[model samples]
Target chain A: QQQVKQSPQSLIVQKGGIPIINCAYENTAFDYFPWYQQFPGKGPALLIAIRPDVSEKKEGRFTISFNKSAKQFSLHIMDSQPGDSATYFCAARRYRDDKIIFGKGTRLHILP
Target chain B: DAGITQSPRYKITETGRQVTLMCHQTWSHSYMFWYRQDLGHGLRLIYYSAAADITDKGEVPDGYVVSRSKTENFPLTLESATRSQTSVYFCASSGYFGDKDRWYGYTFGSGTRLTVV
Candidate 1:
């Protein structure tokens, strides 16, 4: 079964605009939620993460808004730039579990 | 220099041949994992090791084998390459769960693109 589900397989937005990607997971045991950014020909890198205890987290222009009751989380890119265009992945993990489950992905494009 | 690395960034193998992808890390992290990325399926774990001499299967482990002989090395071998095996492979390492402060998240190697013909 798909433990995590993501929407908007692809997205496009103008520079300086805000682009959001959403994800929902089924497992309440998940305590860690992280977002990863991947440029073509490169591996995905951790962008930002949030714990279930908090409702939101922000790092630079990236923010993660999480709703524990809804089992949903979303990543928002503020004042996005063309440099931000890439594929993004949302992942979840249990506190002590060694494995991380990843969502399919969203390919984002920031138009210059 | 202190990061995970994957060798042979690209490879092409004939069907039914044996191919192996190598992964190494300098941080000596206790957990290492292998994942395959497909166009629509995202990253699916194939195998993982919590430490040397310990390994376990992930979502997809058929026709593939993995061995972790030392703390730094985890190699994934395809016993018989098939067209379905063509995909990008990634290796990642992380500190144990107890080190939450140090576990910003997994540190991933670039990736290895494999093609089976």
Candidate 2:
């Protein structure tokens, strides 16, 4: 079973435009939400993360809008750049399981 | 900072061959983990160790082996490599924390691309 499901296997967005990736989780116990950006031949790095207590958290041009009631969260990259083109992964963690469960993945491309 | 790192960066082996991937962390963190990343299987935990001798299997632990003899090194070995075992292996570590409670985030290694031909 895919505990965390992400939509749109891939996406194409123009540079300077906002690109949004959505993720949902079935387990309500999951309180931690984190998004990671992965470049080819590299490991995934934590981009932004938020606890369920806050509805939204923003850092520079990256923002994570979370909905506790909906058990959903989304990452929005403002002023997307060509360098931002990479595979994005959404992860969720619950108290029961210490390991992070990741969504399939979403490959986003920023067009020049 | 020289954090966690995996050796060989890349390796190619044939079926029935035994291969071991080495993971080293300079931070001396007590918690270390091994994960295999596949196309559809995002990141499945293979095994984890809390301390030098405490080890446990993870979500996907079949056809794999792990050990944490020292606090900084966690090695994973495949008894007999199989085609299905070919994947990018990543090693991650977190500062020791209480069970089921909040723990420090993980620091991941670059990764090792392994191929079983």
Candidate 3:
């Protein structure tokens, strides 16, 4: 069973447009939520993260809107560019647990 | 040289051949993990270790083996390679910072593209 479920396996957006990727989790014990970005021929890198305490968090052009009650969180990229095109993954981790569960993934493409 | 790294960026092995992938980290992080990434399946954990000499299986550990004899090294081995095991492998290490509230994150290696025939 997939603990974390991500929607829209792939996404395409125009440059300067916003691309939103959403994820939902089944475990309420998960307290930490993070997003990762991966490019071709490279490993995934941490993009941004959010804690359930707040409903939203923003860093630069990336924003994470988290809905604790609904057990859903979404990542939004503002003014996306061609460089932002990559694979994105949403992950969840339980408090004090070293294991972090990841969603399948979302491939985002930005057209210039 | 301050982050995690994986050896043999790419490899091709025949079926029934044993292969070993190496992973090394400079951060001395307490937790290390091995994951395989495939199309449509994303990243799936194969094994993890909290510290040296302590290892555990993850979601997929059917034909893989892992050992962490030292803090800086965590090597994964396949006793007998199978075509189904062909996938990109990643090694990661996690650490915490901050005094009041700890912040945790993972640093991933470049990855090893393994192809089994």
Candidate 4:
């Protein structure tokens, strides 16, 4: 079973617009949630992360809105740019465990 | 000059042949992992090592083997290649998860694209 599930396998937004990608998880034991961004021919890099204790976290133009009770989290990109086009993945893990379960990923595109 | 790296950025092999993907890290991180990414399936873990000589299976381990003889190197071996195994493989390293203060997120390598014909 997929521990983490992501929606909208692909997304498109105009530059300067906002694009949102969402993910849901079943494991309540999960304590850490992180989003990764991957460009073609490159490995996924950490974008931003949030702990369940907080409702949201932001870094630059990226924001992670997390709902602990709902077991859901979403990534929102503000002022989306053409360079933001890439694949995004959401992951979850427990505080004591070393393994991270990743979502299926969403490919995002920004039209100039 | 110090980071994780994958070998043979690209490789092509015939079915039934043996192939191995190599990964190395210079930061001496205590944890190393192998993951394979496929279209629509995302990235699935193949194997991981918490320390030297301590290796464990991940979400997808069938038809794959891994070893951690040294702190810096972890290699994944396919005893017999299969068409289904063709995908982009990535290696990542991180500090001990037990260390809450220094638990920097995983650092990934450039990845190796392997094709099984």
CA RMSD per model (angstroms) = 1.2, 2.2, 1.1, 1.3
Clashing pairs in 3: none
Choose 3 or 4, whichever is better by lDDT: 3
Which lDDT value does model 2 have at A58?
97
Candidate 3 residue lDDT tens string, A7-108: 889999999999999999999888789999999999999999998998999999999999999999999999999999999999998676568899999999
Q: In model 2 chain A, which range of ten residues has the least summed lDDT?
A: A93-102
Candidate 4 chain A lowest-lDDT run of ten: A93-102
- Writing each residue's lDDT as its tens digit, candidate 1 over B38-112 gives 999999999999899999999999999999989999999999999999999999997845657547788899999
- Candidate 2's docking class is medium
The parts of candidate 4 lying over 4 Å away from their true place are B96-98
lDDT of 2: 0.87
Pairing residues by index, what is the TM-score of model 1? 0.97
- Candidate 3 local lDDT, residue A4: 99
Order by DockQ, highest first: 3, 1, 4, 2
Evaluated at residue B16, the lDDT of candidate 4 is 99
Error of 3 at B97 (Å): 1.4
User: Could you tell me every candidate's TM-score relative to the true structure?
Assistant: 0.97, 0.92, 0.98, 0.97
Residue pairs in collision within model 1: none
TM-score of 4: 0.97
C-alpha RMSD between model 4 and the true structure: 1.3
Model 2 / residue A48 / CA error / Å:
0.7
Q: What is the lDDT of residue A7 in candidate 2?
A: 70
CAPRI grade, predicted model 3: high
